[model samples]
Target: MIRSIIHDEMFLSVPSEKAGKEHLQTVQDLRDTLHSVRERCAGMAANMIGVNKNIIAVTMPFGEMVMINPVIIRKAEPYETEEGCLSLKGQRKTTRYRKITVRWQNENMEVMKADFSGFTAQVIQHEIDHCAGIVI
Candidate 1:
């Protein structure tokens, strides 16, 4: 049997006391969305782009990372270079960032921390922005 490649899990909205219907689904949607996010994050890993406000956001299996309420822990001096993303299609441009530390909770309610440098750092920032509902 062919395995499913769809993800529909949605993260919880901020301030649990005031969560809306989208944040309180029946569960299946949540699982699917989360799965899709991971897959997109992983598959798009090779194609992630550097930080560029002018550049379009990267595309993913579930549309986009669409992360909600994300925050950056630390950042290092930035360097400049061209960048690309799977979502950006066949394009590249100069981006900046030296090294950065990131922390964020996933749809599964787990905290993840990682150190990123060069291209990876930019990708993480891009993805985190996606998680926080940033399109660019």
Candidate 2:
């Protein structure tokens, strides 16, 4: 289903962890939401669709991927960039890392980690901010 993108107070509020079986649904929802907006969006967070959970779906160079409870473990030097959100129009000036290592869970609830750089790193940072209830 194509969930509505939330831009209210809740969207700006920090999201909670989605653990156990409930996360399966949230993951699917995030995937669905990401698919609905992938054409114009690089990624999306659960809060953007009014689901206050640490879930995000992103479009990588290879393909689309889902992250559950994603956390940035390492980061390189900071760089300023312009980023926009699906829940909000217009771009905002935000600072992001040039390279990063993130740890997250997949749809099967398996833990995984990977390295990202350049634009991909910036996109991951932006999605992480949304998981923390930040717009920019």
Candidate 3:
């Protein structure tokens, strides 16, 4: 289902819980919601749709990818940039890494890890921040 974008700062500030196999539906919802807003948004976290699960959907060059319980294991080369969120009023300045290595689960609940950089990496870092309850 395509869920509504949450704008409540208090709600968005609370950290999301780890996702499990049972949260598969939330993953689908994230994908659906992300696709629905693809024109203006490149990524979305589960909390953005009002679900407090550590799940995020990102639009890659090939297609949309969902990351469950994503964790940034390593990051390098930080730089400052501004970003806008569908759940927020305007863009905010923040520091982001040029490269990041993440460990997460796929839709099937299988573990996956990979390195990402440039814009893709920046988008992942932003979504992960949502999981951590950090608004930037």
Candidate 4:
């Protein structure tokens, strides 16, 4: 189910709750929504689709991935960059890490941890920020 992109700053500002196995459908929906907007967006959070759950979908060079309750365990090499969102107008300047290690759950609810770098890492960081209710 492709959901609508939420633009309400107040709603987007509120932090999302942790996702569980029961939230699997939300994960699918987030992926669907992300794919729907792939031409203009590279990633999306559950909150961006109006569901306040700690879920995010990102498009990588290989494929698309969904992260539930993602946490950034480590970050290295910070740099400034500007980003745009389907839920927000224009791009905003923010600091991002060139490399990041994250722990998150897959669609099956299994824990997965891995390191990401460059654009992929940046996209993950941005989506994680959405989960934390920080709209950059």
lDDT of candidate 4 over 1-136, digit per residue (tens): 9898999999999999989999989988988888888888999999999999999999976667999999999999999999988889999999999999999999888899999999999999999999999998
Q: For model 3, how big is the CA root-mean-square deviation?
A: 0.7
lDDT by residue (1-136, candidate 1, tens digit) is 1123222222211111211224423123323433455543332211122111111122344543422233568887866655433344444554456788766444463566666676556765655544443333
What residue runs in model 1 are displaced by over 4 Å at the alpha carbon? 1-69, 129-136
Q: In candidate 4, residue 50 scores what lDDT?
A: 90
Q: On a 0 to 100 scale, what is the lDDT of residue 55 in model 3?
A: 97
- The estimated TM-scores of all candidates read 0.43, 0.91, 0.98, 0.97
Best of the candidates, lDDT: 3
Write candidate 3's Cα lDDT for 1-136 as tens digits.
Answer: 9998999999999999999999999999999999999989999999999999999999987878999999999999999999998899889999999999999999888899999999999999999999999987
Q: What would you estimate as the lDDT of candidate 2?
A: 0.82
Query: The CA-based lDDT of model 1 is what?
Result: 0.40
Superposed by TM-score, candidate 2 places the C-alpha of residue 85 at a distance from the truth, in angstroms, of 1.2
lDDT of 4 at 95: 98
* Worst window of 10 by summed lDDT in candidate 1: 46-55
Model 2 C-alpha lDDT per residue in residues 21-75, reported as the tens digit of each score: 5767777777787887778989988888777788888897676788888999999
* Most accurate candidate by TM-score: 3
lDDT of 3 at 39: 87
